[model samples]
Target: MTHAELHADAFATLSAWTPPSHGQFSLREAYLGFLAARPDATARSCAPGHLTASAVVMSADRRSVLLTLHPRVGRWLQLGGHCEDGDSSLAAAAFREATEESGIDGLVMDPAPLDLDVHPITCSLGIPTRHFDVRFLVTAPPGAVAVISDESDDLRFWPVDALPPGTDASVTTLVAAAVARG
Candidate 1:
Protein backbone atom coordinates (compact mmCIF):
# COMPACT_ATOMS: atom_id res chain seq x y z
CA MET A 1 0.00 0.00 0.00
CA THR A 2 1.02 3.59 -0.58
CA HIS A 3 1.89 5.91 2.28
CA ALA A 4 -1.40 7.73 1.97
CA GLU A 5 -3.44 4.55 2.03
CA LEU A 6 -1.34 3.28 4.88
CA HIS A 7 -2.00 6.40 6.88
CA ALA A 8 -5.73 6.19 6.25
CA ASP A 9 -5.72 2.58 7.33
CA ALA A 10 -3.66 3.41 10.39
CA PHE A 11 -5.96 6.24 11.27
CA ALA A 12 -8.91 3.89 11.05
CA THR A 13 -7.11 1.49 13.31
CA LEU A 14 -6.48 4.29 15.77
CA SER A 15 -10.04 5.53 15.55
CA ALA A 16 -11.44 2.12 16.32
CA TRP A 17 -9.10 1.59 19.23
CA THR A 18 -9.96 2.24 22.82
CA PRO A 19 -7.52 4.58 24.46
CA PRO A 20 -5.69 3.40 27.52
CA SER A 21 -7.46 4.53 30.67
CA HIS A 22 -4.57 6.82 31.52
CA GLY A 23 -4.61 8.76 28.24
CA GLN A 24 -5.72 12.34 28.02
CA PHE A 25 -9.39 12.64 27.08
CA SER A 26 -8.87 15.28 24.40
CA LEU A 27 -6.11 13.63 22.41
CA ARG A 28 -8.37 11.37 20.32
CA GLU A 29 -10.78 14.14 19.40
CA ALA A 30 -7.89 16.44 18.43
CA TYR A 31 -6.34 13.82 16.19
CA LEU A 32 -9.65 13.01 14.46
CA GLY A 33 -10.23 16.69 13.81
CA PHE A 34 -6.74 17.05 12.40
CA LEU A 35 -7.59 14.23 9.98
CA ALA A 36 -10.80 15.90 8.92
CA ALA A 37 -9.09 19.24 8.44
CA ARG A 38 -6.39 17.96 6.15
CA PRO A 39 -6.91 15.31 3.47
CA ASP A 40 -3.17 15.25 2.76
CA ALA A 41 -2.36 14.89 6.41
CA THR A 42 -0.48 11.71 5.69
CA ALA A 43 1.64 13.25 2.93
CA ARG A 44 3.17 16.17 4.81
CA SER A 45 0.72 18.46 3.03
CA CYS A 46 1.18 20.63 6.11
CA ALA A 47 -2.07 22.44 6.54
CA PRO A 48 -3.37 22.45 10.08
CA GLY A 49 -0.89 19.75 10.92
CA HIS A 50 1.06 16.87 9.44
CA LEU A 51 1.42 13.17 10.05
CA THR A 52 4.46 12.14 12.08
CA ALA A 53 5.38 8.67 13.31
CA SER A 54 7.37 7.77 16.42
CA ALA A 55 8.72 4.64 18.05
CA VAL A 56 9.23 3.98 21.71
CA VAL A 57 12.33 1.86 21.24
CA MET A 58 13.17 -0.74 23.83
CA SER A 59 16.12 -3.06 24.33
CA ALA A 60 15.73 -6.83 24.02
CA ASP A 61 15.44 -7.15 27.77
CA ARG A 62 12.91 -4.29 27.86
CA ARG A 63 14.82 -2.71 30.70
CA SER A 64 15.85 0.39 28.78
CA VAL A 65 14.54 2.78 26.11
CA LEU A 66 16.54 4.57 23.44
CA LEU A 67 15.99 8.32 23.40
CA THR A 68 17.34 11.11 21.26
CA LEU A 69 18.11 14.64 22.31
CA HIS A 70 16.16 16.43 19.60
CA PRO A 71 17.99 19.48 18.34
CA ARG A 72 14.87 21.47 17.60
CA VAL A 73 12.84 20.46 20.64
CA GLY A 74 15.93 20.63 22.85
CA ARG A 75 14.62 17.74 24.87
CA TRP A 76 15.06 13.98 25.05
CA LEU A 77 12.37 12.20 23.06
CA GLN A 78 11.50 8.94 21.32
CA LEU A 79 12.93 8.35 17.86
CA GLY A 80 10.59 9.66 15.17
CA GLY A 81 10.01 12.12 12.38
CA HIS A 82 7.70 13.09 9.52
CA CYS A 83 6.38 10.35 7.23
CA GLU A 84 8.38 9.85 4.07
CA ASP A 85 7.12 8.93 0.61
CA GLY A 86 8.99 5.64 0.78
CA ASP A 87 7.01 4.57 3.80
CA SER A 88 4.24 2.02 3.18
CA SER A 89 2.48 2.21 6.55
CA LEU A 90 2.43 4.30 9.69
CA ALA A 91 4.22 1.46 11.45
CA ALA A 92 6.72 1.43 8.62
CA ALA A 93 7.16 5.16 8.93
CA ALA A 94 7.79 4.85 12.63
CA PHE A 95 10.23 2.01 12.12
CA ARG A 96 12.04 3.85 9.37
CA GLU A 97 12.43 6.90 11.53
CA ALA A 98 13.71 4.80 14.40
CA THR A 99 16.26 3.09 12.16
CA GLU A 100 17.42 6.28 10.49
CA GLU A 101 17.69 8.31 13.65
CA SER A 102 19.08 5.62 15.87
CA GLY A 103 21.26 4.02 13.19
CA ILE A 104 20.03 0.65 14.31
CA ASP A 105 18.83 -1.90 11.79
CA GLY A 106 16.90 -5.16 12.06
CA LEU A 107 14.64 -3.69 14.68
CA VAL A 108 11.20 -5.22 15.30
CA MET A 109 8.09 -3.06 15.55
CA ASP A 110 4.58 -3.68 16.83
CA PRO A 111 2.01 -2.91 14.14
CA ALA A 112 -0.48 -1.42 16.50
CA PRO A 113 0.25 2.07 17.78
CA LEU A 114 1.25 2.48 21.42
CA ASP A 115 -0.23 5.97 21.78
CA LEU A 116 -0.97 9.30 20.07
CA ASP A 117 0.00 12.86 20.81
CA VAL A 118 -0.93 16.08 19.00
CA HIS A 119 1.30 19.06 19.64
CA PRO A 120 2.31 22.28 17.95
CA ILE A 121 5.65 22.69 16.23
CA THR A 122 7.46 25.28 14.17
CA CYS A 123 8.04 23.65 10.81
CA SER A 124 10.88 24.21 8.41
CA LEU A 125 8.14 24.70 5.82
CA GLY A 126 7.57 28.14 7.38
CA ILE A 127 4.30 27.36 9.06
CA PRO A 128 3.04 26.87 12.57
CA THR A 129 1.87 23.31 12.75
CA ARG A 130 0.85 20.43 14.90
CA HIS A 131 2.24 16.96 14.53
CA PHE A 132 -0.32 14.20 14.77
CA ASP A 133 2.21 11.82 16.25
CA VAL A 134 1.29 8.17 15.90
CA ARG A 135 3.55 6.19 18.18
CA PHE A 136 4.55 2.53 17.81
CA LEU A 137 6.72 0.16 19.76
CA VAL A 138 10.13 -0.92 18.41
CA THR A 139 12.55 -3.40 19.90
CA ALA A 140 16.28 -3.56 19.42
CA PRO A 141 18.17 -6.80 19.62
CA PRO A 142 20.65 -7.43 22.44
CA GLY A 143 23.87 -5.41 22.15
CA ALA A 144 22.36 -3.13 19.53
CA VAL A 145 24.67 -0.22 18.80
CA ALA A 146 23.30 3.26 18.09
CA VAL A 147 25.03 6.12 16.31
CA ILE A 148 23.57 9.57 16.71
CA SER A 149 22.34 11.25 13.55
CA ASP A 150 22.82 14.96 12.87
CA GLU A 151 19.22 15.49 13.88
CA SER A 152 20.08 14.85 17.50
CA ASP A 153 22.61 16.14 19.97
CA ASP A 154 22.90 12.76 21.67
CA LEU A 155 21.54 9.22 21.73
CA ARG A 156 21.44 6.92 24.71
CA PHE A 157 19.61 3.99 26.23
CA TRP A 158 17.92 5.16 29.42
CA PRO A 159 16.97 2.82 32.16
CA VAL A 160 13.23 2.25 32.35
CA ASP A 161 13.44 3.18 36.01
CA ALA A 162 15.49 6.32 35.36
CA LEU A 163 14.80 8.37 32.26
CA PRO A 164 16.50 11.69 31.55
CA PRO A 165 15.57 14.90 33.33
CA GLY A 166 13.74 16.46 30.40
CA THR A 167 11.90 13.34 29.28
CA ASP A 168 8.23 13.95 28.76
CA ALA A 169 5.75 12.23 30.97
CA SER A 170 3.87 10.93 27.93
CA VAL A 171 7.08 9.26 26.79
CA THR A 172 7.26 7.39 30.06
CA THR A 173 3.65 6.40 29.57
CA LEU A 174 4.34 5.13 26.07
CA VAL A 175 7.24 3.10 27.40
CA ALA A 176 4.97 1.55 29.99
CA ALA A 177 2.39 0.71 27.37
CA ALA A 178 5.02 -0.87 25.12
CA VAL A 179 6.36 -2.95 28.00
CA ALA A 180 2.85 -4.04 28.97
CA ARG A 181 2.02 -5.01 25.39
CA GLY A 182 5.22 -7.01 25.12
Candidate 2:
Protein backbone atom coordinates (compact mmCIF):
# COMPACT_ATOMS: atom_id res chain seq x y z
CA MET A 1 0.00 0.00 0.00
CA THR A 2 0.99 3.59 -0.50
CA HIS A 3 2.01 5.70 2.46
CA ALA A 4 -1.34 7.44 2.50
CA GLU A 5 -3.22 4.12 2.59
CA LEU A 6 -1.29 2.96 5.62
CA HIS A 7 -2.05 6.21 7.41
CA ALA A 8 -5.73 5.77 6.70
CA ASP A 9 -5.58 2.23 8.01
CA ALA A 10 -3.99 3.47 11.20
CA PHE A 11 -6.79 5.93 11.73
CA ALA A 12 -9.39 3.26 11.02
CA THR A 13 -7.84 0.70 13.38
CA LEU A 14 -7.64 3.12 16.30
CA SER A 15 -11.13 4.34 15.67
CA ALA A 16 -12.58 0.81 15.65
CA TRP A 17 -10.71 -0.50 18.67
CA THR A 18 -12.55 -0.45 22.01
CA PRO A 19 -9.98 0.19 24.68
CA PRO A 20 -9.92 -2.16 27.64
CA SER A 21 -9.42 0.75 30.07
CA HIS A 22 -10.01 4.45 30.43
CA GLY A 23 -6.31 5.18 30.06
CA GLN A 24 -6.22 3.30 26.78
CA PHE A 25 -9.38 5.07 25.73
CA SER A 26 -7.65 8.38 26.26
CA LEU A 27 -4.65 7.16 24.32
CA ARG A 28 -6.88 6.07 21.49
CA GLU A 29 -8.45 9.48 21.30
CA ALA A 30 -5.11 11.18 21.58
CA TYR A 31 -3.72 9.10 18.74
CA LEU A 32 -6.65 9.88 16.51
CA GLY A 33 -6.18 13.54 17.29
CA PHE A 34 -2.50 13.32 16.46
CA LEU A 35 -3.15 11.59 13.15
CA ALA A 36 -5.74 14.18 12.32
CA ALA A 37 -3.14 16.91 12.78
CA ARG A 38 -0.16 15.31 11.06
CA PRO A 39 -0.50 13.70 7.65
CA ASP A 40 3.12 12.65 7.86
CA ALA A 41 2.51 11.00 11.25
CA THR A 42 3.14 7.54 9.73
CA ALA A 43 6.61 8.41 8.57
CA ARG A 44 9.74 7.84 10.60
CA SER A 45 10.85 11.37 9.70
CA CYS A 46 7.87 12.92 11.40
CA ALA A 47 10.33 14.30 14.04
CA PRO A 48 7.86 14.73 16.87
CA GLY A 49 6.41 11.20 16.78
CA HIS A 50 5.14 8.55 14.41
CA LEU A 51 2.95 5.50 14.26
CA THR A 52 4.81 2.23 14.89
CA ALA A 53 3.42 -1.28 14.68
CA SER A 54 4.28 -4.05 17.12
CA ALA A 55 3.28 -7.61 17.92
CA VAL A 56 2.94 -9.42 21.19
CA VAL A 57 3.60 -12.90 19.86
CA MET A 58 2.22 -15.79 21.85
CA SER A 59 2.96 -19.45 21.33
CA ALA A 60 0.17 -21.60 19.98
CA ASP A 61 -0.63 -23.05 23.38
CA ARG A 62 -0.42 -19.60 24.94
CA ARG A 63 2.35 -20.87 27.22
CA SER A 64 5.10 -18.58 25.95
CA VAL A 65 5.85 -15.24 24.31
CA LEU A 66 8.55 -14.45 21.78
CA LEU A 67 10.54 -11.42 22.88
CA THR A 68 13.44 -9.44 21.52
CA LEU A 69 16.30 -7.89 23.45
CA HIS A 70 16.18 -4.56 21.68
CA PRO A 71 19.66 -3.23 21.10
CA ARG A 72 18.55 0.35 21.58
CA VAL A 73 16.37 -0.17 24.65
CA GLY A 74 18.69 -2.83 26.11
CA ARG A 75 15.69 -4.80 27.30
CA TRP A 76 13.63 -7.80 26.29
CA LEU A 77 10.51 -6.50 24.62
CA GLN A 78 7.91 -7.73 22.16
CA LEU A 79 8.76 -7.89 18.44
CA GLY A 80 7.76 -4.79 16.48
CA GLY A 81 8.99 -1.63 14.82
CA HIS A 82 8.16 1.28 12.53
CA CYS A 83 5.67 1.04 9.73
CA GLU A 84 7.45 0.82 6.39
CA ASP A 85 6.63 2.90 3.34
CA GLY A 86 5.50 -0.23 1.50
CA ASP A 87 3.20 -1.48 4.24
CA SER A 88 -0.36 -2.14 3.15
CA SER A 89 -1.91 -1.42 6.54
CA LEU A 90 -1.04 -0.96 10.19
CA ALA A 91 -1.95 -4.57 10.93
CA ALA A 92 0.21 -5.78 8.05
CA ALA A 93 3.10 -3.69 9.28
CA ALA A 94 2.80 -5.39 12.68
CA PHE A 95 2.69 -8.83 11.09
CA ARG A 96 5.69 -7.98 8.97
CA GLU A 97 7.70 -6.88 11.99
CA ALA A 98 6.86 -10.07 13.87
CA THR A 99 7.75 -12.23 10.91
CA GLU A 100 10.98 -10.39 10.22
CA GLU A 101 12.15 -10.34 13.83
CA SER A 102 11.01 -13.83 14.74
CA GLY A 103 11.98 -15.33 11.35
CA ILE A 104 8.96 -17.51 11.70
CA ASP A 105 6.78 -17.99 8.66
CA GLY A 106 2.99 -18.29 8.78
CA LEU A 107 2.61 -16.42 12.03
CA VAL A 108 -1.06 -15.71 12.57
CA MET A 109 -1.97 -12.15 13.43
CA ASP A 110 -5.22 -10.85 14.81
CA PRO A 111 -6.09 -7.78 12.76
CA ALA A 112 -7.53 -5.85 15.69
CA PRO A 113 -4.99 -3.94 17.76
CA LEU A 114 -4.33 -5.43 21.18
CA ASP A 115 -3.09 -2.26 22.83
CA LEU A 116 -1.57 1.22 22.34
CA ASP A 117 1.44 2.93 23.89
CA VAL A 118 3.29 6.20 23.48
CA HIS A 119 6.90 6.33 24.61
CA PRO A 120 9.85 8.63 24.03
CA ILE A 121 13.09 7.38 22.52
CA THR A 122 15.78 8.05 19.93
CA CYS A 123 14.79 5.80 17.06
CA SER A 124 16.69 5.26 13.78
CA LEU A 125 16.50 8.95 12.93
CA GLY A 126 19.10 9.48 15.70
CA ILE A 127 16.96 12.11 17.40
CA PRO A 128 14.50 11.97 20.27
CA THR A 129 10.99 11.05 19.15
CA ARG A 130 7.98 9.33 20.53
CA HIS A 131 6.70 6.03 19.18
CA PHE A 132 2.95 6.04 19.08
CA ASP A 133 2.95 2.28 19.02
CA VAL A 134 0.00 0.27 17.85
CA ARG A 135 0.29 -3.21 19.37
CA PHE A 136 -1.30 -6.40 18.06
CA LEU A 137 -1.59 -10.02 19.14
CA VAL A 138 0.15 -12.62 16.96
CA THR A 139 0.43 -16.39 17.37
CA ALA A 140 3.53 -18.25 16.37
CA PRO A 141 3.08 -21.80 15.24
CA PRO A 142 3.92 -24.57 17.68
CA GLY A 143 7.69 -25.10 17.93
CA ALA A 144 8.42 -21.91 16.03
CA VAL A 145 12.07 -20.97 16.20
CA ALA A 146 13.21 -17.34 16.10
CA VAL A 147 16.35 -16.15 14.39
CA ILE A 148 17.57 -12.90 15.88
CA SER A 149 17.66 -10.11 13.34
CA ASP A 150 20.11 -7.21 13.38
CA GLU A 151 17.36 -5.20 15.03
CA SER A 152 17.84 -7.18 18.25
CA ASP A 153 20.79 -8.06 20.42
CA ASP A 154 19.04 -11.36 21.20
CA LEU A 155 15.81 -13.30 20.72
CA ARG A 156 14.04 -16.16 22.48
CA PHE A 157 10.83 -17.42 24.00
CA TRP A 158 9.94 -17.04 27.66
CA PRO A 159 7.12 -18.51 29.67
CA VAL A 160 4.22 -16.12 30.08
CA ASP A 161 4.52 -16.31 33.88
CA ALA A 162 8.31 -16.02 33.88
CA LEU A 163 9.56 -13.16 31.76
CA PRO A 164 13.12 -11.91 32.11
CA PRO A 165 14.03 -9.46 34.86
CA GLY A 166 13.71 -5.77 33.91
CA THR A 167 11.46 -6.40 30.95
CA ASP A 168 9.61 -3.23 29.99
CA ALA A 169 6.36 -2.60 31.86
CA SER A 170 4.70 -2.03 28.51
CA VAL A 171 5.81 -5.54 27.59
CA THR A 172 4.26 -6.92 30.73
CA THR A 173 1.03 -5.14 29.92
CA LEU A 174 1.15 -6.59 26.41
CA VAL A 175 1.67 -10.10 27.75
CA ALA A 176 -1.33 -9.67 30.02
CA ALA A 177 -3.43 -8.50 27.09
CA ALA A 178 -2.30 -11.45 24.98
CA VAL A 179 -3.15 -13.89 27.74
CA ALA A 180 -6.51 -12.28 28.28
CA ARG A 181 -7.20 -12.33 24.57
CA GLY A 182 -6.46 -16.06 24.50
Candidate 3:
Protein backbone atom coordinates (compact mmCIF):
# COMPACT_ATOMS: atom_id res chain seq x y z
CA MET A 1 0.00 0.00 0.00
CA THR A 2 1.03 3.62 -0.45
CA HIS A 3 2.20 5.72 2.50
CA ALA A 4 -1.06 7.59 2.84
CA GLU A 5 -2.99 4.37 2.47
CA LEU A 6 -0.88 2.76 5.21
CA HIS A 7 -1.54 5.60 7.60
CA ALA A 8 -5.23 5.62 6.75
CA ASP A 9 -5.39 1.91 7.42
CA ALA A 10 -3.60 2.33 10.70
CA PHE A 11 -6.00 5.06 11.72
CA ALA A 12 -8.96 2.94 10.75
CA THR A 13 -7.62 0.04 12.77
CA LEU A 14 -7.24 2.26 15.82
CA SER A 15 -10.58 3.98 15.39
CA ALA A 16 -12.51 0.70 15.34
CA TRP A 17 -11.79 -0.10 18.98
CA THR A 18 -13.74 0.84 22.12
CA PRO A 19 -11.32 -0.24 24.76
CA PRO A 20 -12.69 -0.38 28.33
CA SER A 21 -9.47 0.84 29.85
CA HIS A 22 -10.35 4.24 28.54
CA GLY A 23 -12.85 5.48 31.06
CA GLN A 24 -13.63 8.58 29.05
CA PHE A 25 -13.74 9.01 25.28
CA SER A 26 -12.51 6.44 22.79
CA LEU A 27 -9.25 6.66 20.82
CA ARG A 28 -11.25 7.79 17.82
CA GLU A 29 -12.01 11.02 19.63
CA ALA A 30 -8.36 11.81 20.18
CA TYR A 31 -7.47 10.76 16.67
CA LEU A 32 -10.22 13.00 15.36
CA GLY A 33 -8.79 15.95 17.22
CA PHE A 34 -5.40 15.27 15.76
CA LEU A 35 -6.90 14.88 12.33
CA ALA A 36 -8.88 18.09 12.54
CA ALA A 37 -5.87 20.18 13.51
CA ARG A 38 -4.06 18.84 10.49
CA PRO A 39 -6.96 18.12 8.23
CA ASP A 40 -5.82 16.17 5.18
CA ALA A 41 -2.77 15.27 7.24
CA THR A 42 -1.64 13.14 10.18
CA ALA A 43 0.21 14.30 13.25
CA ARG A 44 0.83 13.56 16.91
CA SER A 45 -1.41 14.07 19.93
CA CYS A 46 -1.77 12.69 23.43
CA ALA A 47 -4.18 9.81 23.03
CA PRO A 48 -7.02 9.73 25.51
CA GLY A 49 -6.38 7.15 28.26
CA HIS A 50 -3.11 6.00 26.75
CA LEU A 51 -0.45 5.62 29.39
CA THR A 52 2.51 4.12 27.64
CA ALA A 53 5.51 5.10 25.49
CA SER A 54 7.57 3.20 22.95
CA ALA A 55 10.53 3.67 20.61
CA VAL A 56 11.70 2.21 17.33
CA VAL A 57 15.44 2.44 17.84
CA MET A 58 17.71 2.55 14.81
CA SER A 59 21.42 2.10 14.45
CA ALA A 60 23.54 5.20 14.03
CA ASP A 61 24.31 4.10 10.50
CA ARG A 62 20.60 3.71 9.89
CA ARG A 63 20.98 0.19 8.63
CA SER A 64 18.85 -1.62 11.18
CA VAL A 65 16.28 -1.18 13.88
CA LEU A 66 16.09 -2.86 17.25
CA LEU A 67 13.17 -5.18 17.88
CA THR A 68 12.10 -7.46 20.70
CA LEU A 69 9.97 -10.57 20.77
CA HIS A 70 7.23 -9.89 23.28
CA PRO A 71 6.46 -12.91 25.42
CA ARG A 72 2.70 -12.49 25.60
CA VAL A 73 2.17 -10.86 22.24
CA GLY A 74 4.61 -13.23 20.58
CA ARG A 75 5.29 -10.64 17.94
CA TRP A 76 8.31 -8.58 17.03
CA LEU A 77 7.74 -5.08 18.32
CA GLN A 78 9.33 -1.84 19.36
CA LEU A 79 10.44 -1.45 22.95
CA GLY A 80 7.82 0.05 25.21
CA GLY A 81 5.65 -0.36 28.28
CA HIS A 82 3.19 1.42 30.51
CA CYS A 83 4.38 4.82 31.63
CA GLU A 84 5.35 5.23 35.25
CA ASP A 85 4.55 8.37 37.25
CA GLY A 86 8.24 9.15 37.46
CA ASP A 87 8.53 9.90 33.75
CA SER A 88 8.60 13.63 33.09
CA SER A 89 7.65 13.37 29.43
CA LEU A 90 6.52 10.83 26.85
CA ALA A 91 9.92 11.06 25.17
CA ALA A 92 11.59 10.18 28.43
CA ALA A 93 9.28 7.24 28.86
CA ALA A 94 10.10 5.99 25.38
CA PHE A 95 13.81 6.42 26.06
CA ARG A 96 13.51 4.50 29.31
CA GLU A 97 11.66 1.66 27.63
CA ALA A 98 14.23 1.44 24.84
CA THR A 99 17.11 1.24 27.27
CA GLU A 100 15.43 -1.22 29.58
CA GLU A 101 14.22 -3.54 26.88
CA SER A 102 17.29 -3.47 24.72
CA GLY A 103 19.98 -2.96 27.38
CA ILE A 104 21.54 -0.44 25.04
CA ASP A 105 22.49 2.62 27.01
CA GLY A 106 23.49 6.06 25.82
CA LEU A 107 21.01 6.14 23.02
CA VAL A 108 19.76 9.48 21.83
CA MET A 109 16.03 9.98 22.03
CA ASP A 110 14.38 12.18 19.44
CA PRO A 111 12.09 14.90 20.65
CA ALA A 112 9.38 14.51 18.02
CA PRO A 113 7.15 11.47 17.91
CA LEU A 114 7.93 9.11 15.08
CA ASP A 115 4.42 7.75 14.95
CA LEU A 116 1.17 7.41 16.89
CA ASP A 117 -0.66 4.09 16.98
CA VAL A 118 -3.66 3.41 19.19
CA HIS A 119 -4.94 -0.15 19.49
CA PRO A 120 -6.87 -2.35 21.89
CA ILE A 121 -5.25 -5.19 23.72
CA THR A 122 -7.40 -7.86 25.32
CA CYS A 123 -6.55 -8.77 28.87
CA SER A 124 -6.96 -12.10 30.59
CA LEU A 125 -10.60 -11.30 31.30
CA GLY A 126 -11.18 -10.78 27.59
CA ILE A 127 -11.83 -7.14 28.31
CA PRO A 128 -10.26 -4.74 25.86
CA THR A 129 -7.31 -2.81 27.23
CA ARG A 130 -6.27 0.30 25.34
CA HIS A 131 -2.97 1.97 24.67
CA PHE A 132 -2.41 5.20 22.82
CA ASP A 133 1.12 4.40 21.84
CA VAL A 134 3.55 7.29 21.42
CA ARG A 135 6.42 6.02 19.35
CA PHE A 136 9.77 7.79 19.00
CA LEU A 137 12.68 7.17 16.73
CA VAL A 138 15.80 6.70 18.80
CA THR A 139 19.34 6.40 17.52
CA ALA A 140 21.85 3.97 18.98
CA PRO A 141 25.59 4.03 18.52
CA PRO A 142 27.10 1.84 15.86
CA GLY A 143 27.93 -1.77 16.69
CA ALA A 144 25.83 -1.64 19.82
CA VAL A 145 24.67 -4.99 21.10
CA ALA A 146 21.21 -5.43 22.56
CA VAL A 147 20.68 -7.54 25.65
CA ILE A 148 17.24 -8.99 26.08
CA SER A 149 15.26 -8.10 29.19
CA ASP A 150 12.71 -10.17 31.01
CA GLU A 151 9.92 -8.52 29.06
CA SER A 152 11.35 -9.98 25.87
CA ASP A 153 12.65 -13.47 25.20
CA ASP A 154 14.86 -12.33 22.32
CA LEU A 155 16.29 -9.14 20.95
CA ARG A 156 17.81 -8.46 17.56
CA PHE A 157 18.50 -5.82 14.96
CA TRP A 158 16.93 -6.26 11.57
CA PRO A 159 17.11 -4.34 8.34
CA VAL A 160 14.18 -2.04 7.76
CA ASP A 161 12.83 -4.17 4.93
CA ALA A 162 13.62 -7.53 6.53
CA LEU A 163 11.60 -7.35 9.73
CA PRO A 164 10.74 -10.56 11.53
CA PRO A 165 7.67 -12.60 10.77
CA GLY A 166 4.44 -11.37 12.39
CA THR A 167 5.81 -7.92 12.97
CA ASP A 168 3.26 -5.31 13.97
CA ALA A 169 2.06 -3.36 10.93
CA SER A 170 2.06 -0.15 12.92
CA VAL A 171 5.74 -0.63 13.60
CA THR A 172 6.44 -1.26 9.96
CA THR A 173 4.67 1.95 9.00
CA LEU A 174 6.50 3.96 11.65
CA VAL A 175 9.88 2.66 10.56
CA ALA A 176 9.12 3.51 6.96
CA ALA A 177 8.17 7.04 7.94
CA ALA A 178 11.31 7.45 10.00
CA VAL A 179 13.49 6.29 7.14
CA ALA A 180 11.74 8.59 4.75
CA ARG A 181 12.24 11.55 7.06
CA GLY A 182 15.97 10.94 6.89
Best model per TM-score: 2
Residue lDDT tens for model 1, 40-101: 88877666778789999999999999999989889899999888877888888899999999
lDDT over C-alpha atoms for residue 64 of model 3: 90
Provide the overall lDDT of each model, using Cα atoms, as 2-decimal numbers: 0.84, 0.93, 0.70
Mind giving the per-residue lDDT tens digits that candidate 3 earns over 1-182? 23244345434644544432343245446765554453323212223333457999998888799989888888888898765545655677789889999999789887666666777775332456566676778999878999988999789999998998777778888788668756
Better of 1 and 2 by lDDT: 2
Q: After superposition, how far is residue 141 of candidate 2 from its true place, in Å?
A: 0.8
lDDT of 3 at 89: 59
Clashing pairs in 3: none
Write the number of the candidate with greater lDDT, choosing between 2 and 3. Answer: 2
